[model samples]
Target: MGTGNADADAVLRILVVEDEALIALELECLLDDLGHVTVGVAGNATEAIAMGRSTAPDVALVDIHLVDGPTGIEVARALSADRRTTVVFMTANAKRIPADFAGAIGVIAKPYSERVVASTLDYVADRRAGRDGPACPDGFWPAPV
Candidate 1:
Protein backbone atom coordinates (compact mmCIF):
# COMPACT_ATOMS: atom_id res chain seq x y z
CA MET A 1 0.00 0.00 0.00
CA GLY A 2 2.89 2.27 -0.75
CA THR A 3 3.71 4.82 1.98
CA GLY A 4 0.55 6.74 2.56
CA ASN A 5 -1.47 5.38 5.46
CA ALA A 6 0.26 3.40 8.16
CA ASP A 7 -2.89 1.49 9.01
CA ALA A 8 -2.63 -1.82 7.18
CA ASP A 9 -6.35 -2.41 7.30
CA ALA A 10 -7.05 0.59 5.06
CA VAL A 11 -5.12 -0.84 2.16
CA LEU A 12 -6.87 -2.60 -0.67
CA ARG A 13 -5.40 -5.53 -2.55
CA ILE A 14 -5.80 -4.61 -6.20
CA LEU A 15 -5.39 -6.74 -9.30
CA VAL A 16 -4.18 -5.10 -12.49
CA VAL A 17 -4.82 -6.57 -15.94
CA GLU A 18 -3.20 -4.73 -18.80
CA ASP A 19 -1.02 -6.05 -21.61
CA GLU A 20 1.09 -2.99 -22.31
CA ALA A 21 4.13 -2.97 -20.10
CA LEU A 22 4.36 0.78 -19.73
CA ILE A 23 0.68 1.20 -19.02
CA ALA A 24 0.81 -1.62 -16.52
CA LEU A 25 3.74 -0.02 -14.78
CA GLU A 26 2.04 3.35 -14.66
CA LEU A 27 -1.13 1.80 -13.36
CA GLU A 28 0.80 0.03 -10.64
CA CYS A 29 2.58 3.21 -9.70
CA LEU A 30 -0.66 5.09 -9.60
CA LEU A 31 -2.31 2.51 -7.38
CA ASP A 32 0.73 2.49 -5.13
CA ASP A 33 0.69 6.25 -5.01
CA LEU A 34 -2.90 6.02 -3.84
CA GLY A 35 -1.83 3.62 -1.09
CA HIS A 36 -3.37 0.52 -2.53
CA VAL A 37 -1.74 -2.90 -2.84
CA THR A 38 -0.93 -4.38 -6.20
CA VAL A 39 -1.82 -7.96 -5.47
CA GLY A 40 -0.62 -9.03 -8.93
CA VAL A 41 -0.77 -8.19 -12.58
CA ALA A 42 -1.67 -10.34 -15.59
CA GLY A 43 -1.49 -9.77 -19.30
CA ASN A 44 -4.00 -12.37 -20.32
CA ALA A 45 -7.23 -13.93 -19.22
CA THR A 46 -5.59 -17.12 -17.98
CA GLU A 47 -3.00 -15.30 -15.92
CA ALA A 48 -5.62 -12.87 -14.68
CA ILE A 49 -7.75 -15.74 -13.48
CA ALA A 50 -4.79 -17.31 -11.79
CA MET A 51 -3.85 -14.10 -10.07
CA GLY A 52 -7.43 -13.54 -8.96
CA ARG A 53 -7.57 -17.01 -7.46
CA SER A 54 -4.35 -16.50 -5.58
CA THR A 55 -4.70 -12.86 -4.59
CA ALA A 56 -8.37 -12.54 -3.83
CA PRO A 57 -8.14 -8.87 -4.64
CA ASP A 58 -10.57 -6.45 -3.10
CA VAL A 59 -10.63 -4.47 -6.31
CA ALA A 60 -9.60 -5.05 -9.90
CA LEU A 61 -8.62 -2.48 -12.49
CA VAL A 62 -9.11 -4.37 -15.72
CA ASP A 63 -8.44 -3.44 -19.30
CA ILE A 64 -11.02 -4.33 -21.92
CA HIS A 65 -8.55 -5.78 -24.42
CA LEU A 66 -5.54 -7.90 -23.57
CA VAL A 67 -2.64 -9.24 -25.54
CA ASP A 68 -4.17 -12.71 -25.45
CA GLY A 69 -7.57 -11.45 -26.62
CA PRO A 70 -10.49 -9.15 -25.98
CA THR A 71 -11.35 -11.31 -23.03
CA GLY A 72 -11.08 -8.67 -20.36
CA ILE A 73 -14.77 -7.93 -20.46
CA GLU A 74 -15.55 -11.47 -19.41
CA VAL A 75 -12.62 -11.42 -17.03
CA ALA A 76 -14.11 -8.43 -15.23
CA ARG A 77 -17.47 -10.19 -14.97
CA ALA A 78 -15.92 -13.36 -13.64
CA LEU A 79 -13.79 -11.53 -11.11
CA SER A 80 -16.77 -9.51 -9.93
CA ALA A 81 -18.85 -12.65 -9.35
CA ASP A 82 -17.15 -13.01 -6.00
CA ARG A 83 -19.27 -10.56 -4.05
CA ARG A 84 -16.33 -9.43 -1.98
CA THR A 85 -14.45 -8.16 -4.97
CA THR A 86 -15.43 -5.29 -7.24
CA VAL A 87 -14.23 -4.80 -10.81
CA VAL A 88 -13.71 -1.57 -12.71
CA PHE A 89 -12.78 -1.31 -16.36
CA MET A 90 -9.95 1.09 -17.08
CA THR A 91 -9.48 1.02 -20.80
CA ALA A 92 -9.05 3.06 -23.93
CA ASN A 93 -11.94 1.26 -25.52
CA ALA A 94 -14.70 2.16 -23.13
CA LYS A 95 -16.97 2.82 -26.08
CA ARG A 96 -16.77 -0.81 -26.98
CA ILE A 97 -18.04 -2.01 -23.64
CA PRO A 98 -21.72 -2.75 -23.51
CA ALA A 99 -23.76 -0.20 -21.60
CA ASP A 100 -25.34 -2.91 -19.48
CA PHE A 101 -22.20 -4.84 -18.64
CA ALA A 102 -23.50 -6.92 -15.77
CA GLY A 103 -20.47 -7.54 -13.59
CA ALA A 104 -18.60 -4.27 -13.35
CA ILE A 105 -19.11 -1.39 -11.00
CA GLY A 106 -17.85 1.24 -13.43
CA VAL A 107 -15.54 2.17 -16.27
CA ILE A 108 -12.68 4.66 -16.06
CA ALA A 109 -11.77 5.72 -19.55
CA LYS A 110 -8.17 5.81 -20.71
CA PRO A 111 -6.08 8.96 -20.32
CA TYR A 112 -7.90 9.55 -17.09
CA SER A 113 -6.36 11.97 -14.70
CA GLU A 114 -4.86 10.63 -11.52
CA ARG A 115 -7.40 12.68 -9.61
CA VAL A 116 -10.22 10.82 -11.30
CA VAL A 117 -8.77 7.46 -10.42
CA ALA A 118 -8.09 8.53 -6.87
CA SER A 119 -11.58 9.87 -6.40
CA THR A 120 -13.14 6.74 -7.80
CA LEU A 121 -10.99 4.54 -5.61
CA ASP A 122 -11.68 6.70 -2.59
CA TYR A 123 -15.31 6.04 -3.25
CA VAL A 124 -14.60 2.32 -3.34
CA ALA A 125 -12.79 2.56 -0.04
CA ASP A 126 -15.76 4.32 1.44
CA ARG A 127 -18.09 1.60 0.22
CA ARG A 128 -15.76 -1.09 1.46
CA ALA A 129 -15.80 0.62 4.80
CA GLY A 130 -19.56 -0.07 4.70
CA ARG A 131 -20.55 3.55 4.20
CA ASP A 132 -22.45 4.05 0.99
CA GLY A 133 -24.42 6.84 -0.60
CA PRO A 134 -24.36 7.08 -4.37
CA ALA A 135 -23.43 4.16 -6.61
CA CYS A 136 -20.35 5.54 -8.39
CA PRO A 137 -18.65 8.63 -9.75
CA ASP A 138 -20.63 11.10 -11.80
CA GLY A 139 -19.99 9.44 -15.14
CA PHE A 140 -20.15 5.81 -14.09
CA TRP A 141 -22.80 3.36 -12.95
CA PRO A 142 -22.54 0.97 -10.04
CA ALA A 143 -22.41 -2.79 -10.54
CA PRO A 144 -25.61 -4.71 -9.95
CA VAL A 145 -26.04 -6.53 -6.68
Candidate 2:
Protein backbone atom coordinates (compact mmCIF):
# COMPACT_ATOMS: atom_id res chain seq x y z
CA MET A 1 0.00 0.00 0.00
CA GLY A 2 1.14 3.52 -0.76
CA THR A 3 1.16 6.56 1.51
CA GLY A 4 -0.83 8.68 -0.90
CA ASN A 5 2.38 10.28 -2.10
CA ALA A 6 3.24 10.77 -5.77
CA ASP A 7 6.62 9.17 -5.52
CA ALA A 8 8.33 6.14 -6.97
CA ASP A 9 6.64 3.91 -4.41
CA ALA A 10 3.31 5.07 -5.76
CA VAL A 11 3.96 3.56 -9.13
CA LEU A 12 1.04 1.33 -10.03
CA ARG A 13 1.36 -2.01 -11.78
CA ILE A 14 -0.96 -1.83 -14.75
CA LEU A 15 -2.53 -4.34 -17.10
CA VAL A 16 -3.80 -3.25 -20.48
CA VAL A 17 -6.66 -5.21 -22.04
CA GLU A 18 -7.12 -3.86 -25.50
CA ASP A 19 -7.34 -5.41 -28.96
CA GLU A 20 -5.75 -2.58 -30.83
CA ALA A 21 -2.01 -3.00 -30.96
CA LEU A 22 -1.25 0.60 -31.73
CA ILE A 23 -3.44 1.89 -28.96
CA ALA A 24 -1.93 -0.59 -26.53
CA LEU A 25 1.55 0.53 -27.47
CA GLU A 26 0.66 4.15 -27.08
CA LEU A 27 -0.83 3.53 -23.68
CA GLU A 28 2.25 1.62 -22.61
CA CYS A 29 4.41 4.56 -23.56
CA LEU A 30 2.16 6.93 -21.69
CA LEU A 31 2.11 4.77 -18.60
CA ASP A 32 5.86 4.55 -18.66
CA ASP A 33 6.16 8.28 -19.00
CA LEU A 34 3.89 8.67 -16.02
CA GLY A 35 6.35 6.58 -13.96
CA HIS A 36 4.07 3.56 -13.80
CA VAL A 37 4.85 0.22 -15.37
CA THR A 38 2.68 -2.12 -17.39
CA VAL A 39 2.67 -5.68 -16.18
CA GLY A 40 1.18 -7.04 -19.37
CA VAL A 41 -0.95 -6.33 -22.39
CA ALA A 42 -3.76 -8.71 -23.33
CA GLY A 43 -5.62 -8.59 -26.63
CA ASN A 44 -8.41 -11.00 -25.73
CA ALA A 45 -10.40 -12.15 -22.76
CA THR A 46 -8.56 -15.42 -22.23
CA GLU A 47 -5.20 -13.74 -22.41
CA ALA A 48 -6.38 -10.92 -20.21
CA ILE A 49 -7.52 -13.33 -17.52
CA ALA A 50 -4.32 -15.31 -17.62
CA MET A 51 -2.06 -12.29 -17.49
CA GLY A 52 -4.14 -10.65 -14.80
CA ARG A 53 -3.92 -13.74 -12.63
CA SER A 54 -0.20 -14.04 -13.08
CA THR A 55 0.61 -10.37 -12.73
CA ALA A 56 -1.90 -9.31 -10.10
CA PRO A 57 -1.73 -5.76 -11.35
CA ASP A 58 -2.83 -2.87 -9.20
CA VAL A 59 -5.01 -1.54 -11.99
CA ALA A 60 -6.39 -2.80 -15.26
CA LEU A 61 -7.17 -0.50 -18.17
CA VAL A 62 -9.63 -2.51 -20.18
CA ASP A 63 -11.40 -1.96 -23.44
CA ILE A 64 -15.05 -2.83 -23.84
CA HIS A 65 -14.39 -4.99 -26.89
CA LEU A 66 -11.39 -7.16 -27.49
CA VAL A 67 -10.12 -9.47 -30.18
CA ASP A 68 -12.49 -12.13 -28.95
CA GLY A 69 -15.53 -9.83 -29.04
CA PRO A 70 -17.14 -7.79 -26.26
CA THR A 71 -15.53 -9.81 -23.52
CA GLY A 72 -13.80 -6.99 -21.62
CA ILE A 73 -16.81 -6.92 -19.36
CA GLU A 74 -16.19 -10.55 -18.49
CA VAL A 75 -12.52 -9.82 -17.97
CA ALA A 76 -13.30 -6.94 -15.60
CA ARG A 77 -15.65 -9.07 -13.54
CA ALA A 78 -13.04 -11.75 -13.13
CA LEU A 79 -10.08 -9.50 -12.38
CA SER A 80 -11.93 -7.19 -10.01
CA ALA A 81 -12.90 -10.25 -8.00
CA ASP A 82 -9.33 -10.11 -6.70
CA ARG A 83 -9.61 -7.33 -4.16
CA ARG A 84 -6.09 -6.20 -4.99
CA THR A 85 -6.99 -5.29 -8.53
CA THR A 86 -8.89 -2.19 -9.58
CA VAL A 87 -10.56 -2.20 -12.96
CA VAL A 88 -11.31 0.78 -15.17
CA PHE A 89 -12.80 0.54 -18.63
CA MET A 90 -11.60 2.52 -21.65
CA THR A 91 -14.15 2.22 -24.34
CA ALA A 92 -16.06 4.07 -27.01
CA ASN A 93 -19.21 2.09 -26.32
CA ALA A 94 -19.82 3.30 -22.80
CA LYS A 95 -23.50 2.57 -23.36
CA ARG A 96 -22.79 -1.13 -23.39
CA ILE A 97 -21.58 -0.98 -19.81
CA PRO A 98 -24.20 -2.39 -17.49
CA ALA A 99 -25.52 -0.42 -14.54
CA ASP A 100 -23.22 -2.29 -12.16
CA PHE A 101 -20.14 -1.69 -14.33
CA ALA A 102 -19.48 -5.46 -14.02
CA GLY A 103 -17.34 -4.71 -10.95
CA ALA A 104 -15.28 -1.93 -12.49
CA ILE A 105 -14.67 1.17 -10.40
CA GLY A 106 -14.85 3.61 -13.29
CA VAL A 107 -14.65 4.16 -17.05
CA ILE A 108 -12.94 6.49 -19.51
CA ALA A 109 -14.48 7.09 -22.85
CA LYS A 110 -12.39 6.46 -25.93
CA PRO A 111 -10.67 9.20 -27.93
CA TYR A 112 -9.50 10.17 -24.48
CA SER A 113 -6.90 12.80 -23.88
CA GLU A 114 -3.64 11.78 -22.28
CA ARG A 115 -4.31 14.22 -19.46
CA VAL A 116 -7.52 12.41 -18.59
CA VAL A 117 -5.82 9.05 -18.57
CA ALA A 118 -3.03 10.37 -16.39
CA SER A 119 -5.39 12.02 -13.93
CA THR A 120 -7.56 8.92 -13.72
CA LEU A 121 -4.58 6.76 -12.91
CA ASP A 122 -3.46 9.21 -10.24
CA TYR A 123 -6.93 9.16 -8.74
CA VAL A 124 -6.95 5.37 -8.74
CA ALA A 125 -3.58 5.26 -7.03
CA ASP A 126 -4.70 7.63 -4.33
CA ARG A 127 -7.92 5.74 -3.73
CA ARG A 128 -6.13 2.42 -3.70
CA ALA A 129 -3.85 3.81 -1.03
CA GLY A 130 -6.89 4.62 1.11
CA ARG A 131 -6.87 8.33 0.40
CA ASP A 132 -9.63 10.34 -1.14
CA GLY A 133 -8.13 11.10 -4.52
CA PRO A 134 -8.69 14.22 -6.55
CA ALA A 135 -12.13 14.86 -7.93
CA CYS A 136 -13.03 12.61 -10.85
CA PRO A 137 -12.08 14.29 -14.10
CA ASP A 138 -14.59 15.39 -16.71
CA GLY A 139 -14.02 12.49 -19.07
CA PHE A 140 -14.26 9.86 -16.36
CA TRP A 141 -17.36 8.18 -15.01
CA PRO A 142 -16.89 6.70 -11.57
CA ALA A 143 -19.22 3.91 -10.53
CA PRO A 144 -20.78 4.32 -7.14
CA VAL A 145 -18.67 2.36 -4.75
Candidate 3:
Protein backbone atom coordinates (compact mmCIF):
# COMPACT_ATOMS: atom_id res chain seq x y z
CA MET A 1 0.00 0.00 0.00
CA GLY A 2 1.13 3.54 -0.80
CA THR A 3 1.32 6.37 1.69
CA GLY A 4 -0.76 8.40 -0.76
CA ASN A 5 2.20 10.57 -1.71
CA ALA A 6 2.84 11.00 -5.42
CA ASP A 7 6.57 11.34 -4.96
CA ALA A 8 6.73 8.16 -2.93
CA ASP A 9 6.87 6.13 -6.14
CA ALA A 10 3.51 4.61 -5.34
CA VAL A 11 3.39 1.23 -6.99
CA LEU A 12 -0.30 0.56 -7.35
CA ARG A 13 -1.77 -2.93 -7.55
CA ILE A 14 -4.04 -2.59 -10.56
CA LEU A 15 -6.51 -5.03 -12.06
CA VAL A 16 -7.30 -5.04 -15.77
CA VAL A 17 -10.96 -5.92 -16.41
CA GLU A 18 -10.86 -5.80 -20.18
CA ASP A 19 -12.02 -8.80 -22.21
CA GLU A 20 -9.72 -8.25 -25.12
CA ALA A 21 -6.55 -10.25 -24.68
CA LEU A 22 -4.36 -7.82 -26.60
CA ILE A 23 -5.64 -4.80 -24.74
CA ALA A 24 -5.22 -6.52 -21.41
CA LEU A 25 -1.69 -7.52 -22.31
CA GLU A 26 -0.85 -4.00 -23.38
CA LEU A 27 -2.21 -2.58 -20.17
CA GLU A 28 -0.29 -5.11 -18.12
CA CYS A 29 2.89 -4.15 -19.96
CA LEU A 30 2.14 -0.47 -19.56
CA LEU A 31 1.52 -0.87 -15.86
CA ASP A 32 4.88 -2.52 -15.53
CA ASP A 33 6.50 0.32 -17.42
CA LEU A 34 4.87 2.77 -15.04
CA GLY A 35 6.46 0.97 -12.10
CA HIS A 36 3.10 -0.36 -11.00
CA VAL A 37 2.06 -3.97 -10.53
CA THR A 38 -0.61 -5.72 -12.53
CA VAL A 39 -2.46 -7.66 -9.88
CA GLY A 40 -4.72 -9.54 -12.24
CA VAL A 41 -6.58 -9.52 -15.55
CA ALA A 42 -10.21 -10.51 -15.87
CA GLY A 43 -12.28 -10.91 -19.03
CA ASN A 44 -15.73 -11.19 -17.49
CA ALA A 45 -17.79 -9.74 -14.71
CA THR A 46 -17.64 -12.89 -12.62
CA GLU A 47 -13.89 -13.13 -12.85
CA ALA A 48 -13.45 -9.42 -12.30
CA ILE A 49 -15.46 -9.38 -9.10
CA ALA A 50 -13.66 -12.45 -7.86
CA MET A 51 -10.25 -10.94 -8.52
CA GLY A 52 -11.24 -7.68 -6.93
CA ARG A 53 -12.17 -9.45 -3.73
CA SER A 54 -9.20 -11.75 -3.73
CA THR A 55 -6.46 -9.33 -4.82
CA ALA A 56 -7.84 -6.14 -3.31
CA PRO A 57 -6.19 -4.03 -5.97
CA ASP A 58 -5.85 -0.31 -5.57
CA VAL A 59 -7.45 0.35 -8.93
CA ALA A 60 -9.43 -1.47 -11.59
CA LEU A 61 -9.54 -0.53 -15.29
CA VAL A 62 -12.82 -1.94 -16.57
CA ASP A 63 -14.30 -2.22 -20.03
CA ILE A 64 -18.02 -1.66 -20.51
CA HIS A 65 -18.68 -4.62 -22.73
CA LEU A 66 -17.04 -7.83 -21.70
CA VAL A 67 -17.02 -11.28 -23.27
CA ASP A 68 -20.14 -12.15 -21.34
CA GLY A 69 -21.98 -8.92 -22.26
CA PRO A 70 -22.34 -5.42 -20.83
CA THR A 71 -21.62 -6.69 -17.36
CA GLY A 72 -18.73 -4.39 -16.60
CA ILE A 73 -21.14 -2.01 -14.96
CA GLU A 74 -22.17 -4.74 -12.56
CA VAL A 75 -18.57 -5.50 -11.77
CA ALA A 76 -17.89 -1.83 -11.09
CA ARG A 77 -20.87 -1.51 -8.80
CA ALA A 78 -19.74 -4.52 -6.83
CA LEU A 79 -16.08 -3.61 -6.61
CA SER A 80 -16.66 0.02 -5.70
CA ALA A 81 -18.69 -1.11 -2.74
CA ASP A 82 -15.36 -1.96 -1.20
CA ARG A 83 -13.73 1.38 -0.49
CA ARG A 84 -10.37 -0.30 -0.76
CA THR A 85 -10.79 -0.52 -4.51
CA THR A 86 -11.20 2.35 -6.91
CA VAL A 87 -12.99 1.67 -10.16
CA VAL A 88 -12.36 3.40 -13.47
CA PHE A 89 -14.16 2.53 -16.64
CA MET A 90 -11.94 1.93 -19.67
CA THR A 91 -14.50 1.56 -22.37
CA ALA A 92 -15.13 2.70 -25.89
CA ASN A 93 -18.82 3.17 -25.11
CA ALA A 94 -18.41 6.12 -22.81
CA LYS A 95 -21.95 7.23 -23.51
CA ARG A 96 -23.23 3.91 -22.28
CA ILE A 97 -21.99 4.54 -18.78
CA PRO A 98 -24.70 5.46 -16.33
CA ALA A 99 -24.81 8.98 -14.99
CA ASP A 100 -23.91 7.70 -11.52
CA PHE A 101 -20.78 6.02 -12.96
CA ALA A 102 -21.69 2.81 -11.12
CA GLY A 103 -19.79 4.14 -8.12
CA ALA A 104 -16.62 4.59 -10.14
CA ILE A 105 -14.40 7.65 -9.98
CA GLY A 106 -14.08 8.24 -13.73
CA VAL A 107 -14.20 6.94 -17.28
CA ILE A 108 -11.33 6.66 -19.74
CA ALA A 109 -12.35 6.53 -23.36
CA LYS A 110 -11.05 3.59 -25.34
CA PRO A 111 -8.34 3.70 -28.00
CA TYR A 112 -6.37 5.43 -25.30
CA SER A 113 -2.81 6.48 -25.79
CA GLU A 114 0.03 5.40 -23.55
CA ARG A 115 0.51 8.96 -22.35
CA VAL A 116 -3.13 9.37 -21.49
CA VAL A 117 -3.22 6.09 -19.60
CA ALA A 118 -0.08 7.00 -17.71
CA SER A 119 -1.44 10.41 -16.76
CA THR A 120 -4.75 8.92 -15.73
CA LEU A 121 -3.06 6.38 -13.46
CA ASP A 122 -1.13 9.15 -11.78
CA TYR A 123 -4.31 11.11 -11.24
CA VAL A 124 -6.07 8.07 -9.84
CA ALA A 125 -3.20 7.34 -7.47
CA ASP A 126 -3.36 10.88 -6.14
CA ARG A 127 -7.08 10.67 -5.70
CA ARG A 128 -6.80 7.37 -3.87
CA ALA A 129 -4.21 8.92 -1.59
CA GLY A 130 -6.84 11.51 -0.61
CA ARG A 131 -5.19 14.16 -2.73
CA ASP A 132 -6.94 16.05 -5.47
CA GLY A 133 -4.87 15.41 -8.52
CA PRO A 134 -4.48 17.84 -11.41
CA ALA A 135 -7.24 18.36 -13.91
CA CYS A 136 -8.56 15.20 -15.54
CA PRO A 137 -6.76 13.96 -18.61
CA ASP A 138 -8.00 14.77 -22.12
CA GLY A 139 -10.08 11.63 -22.71
CA PHE A 140 -11.08 11.08 -19.08
CA TRP A 141 -14.37 12.10 -17.52
CA PRO A 142 -14.39 12.23 -13.73
CA ALA A 143 -17.63 11.25 -12.13
CA PRO A 144 -19.56 13.71 -10.01
CA VAL A 145 -18.92 12.89 -6.40
Identify the leading candidate in terms of TM-score.
2
Q: Is candidate 1 or candidate 2 better by TM-score?
A: 2
| Candidate 3 total steric clashes | 0
Q: Over the stretch 1-145, how does candidate 3's per-residue lDDT look in tens digits?
A: 2212346546688999999999999889888888888999999999999999999999999999999999999999999999999899999988889889999999888888777788888888777677754677676888987
> In candidate 1, which residue pairs clash?
none
lDDT of 1 by residue, 2-32 (tens): 2244356557889999999999999899888
TM-score of 3: 0.91
- The residue-by-residue lDDT of candidate 2 on 120-140, one tens digit each, is 888888788787646776778
TM-score leaderboard ranking: 2, 3, 1
For all candidates in order, the CA lDDT equals 0.80, 0.90, 0.87
- Scored by lDDT, the top model is 2
Q: Candidate 3 overall Cα lDDT vs. reference?
A: 0.87
> 1 or 2, which is superior by lDDT?
2
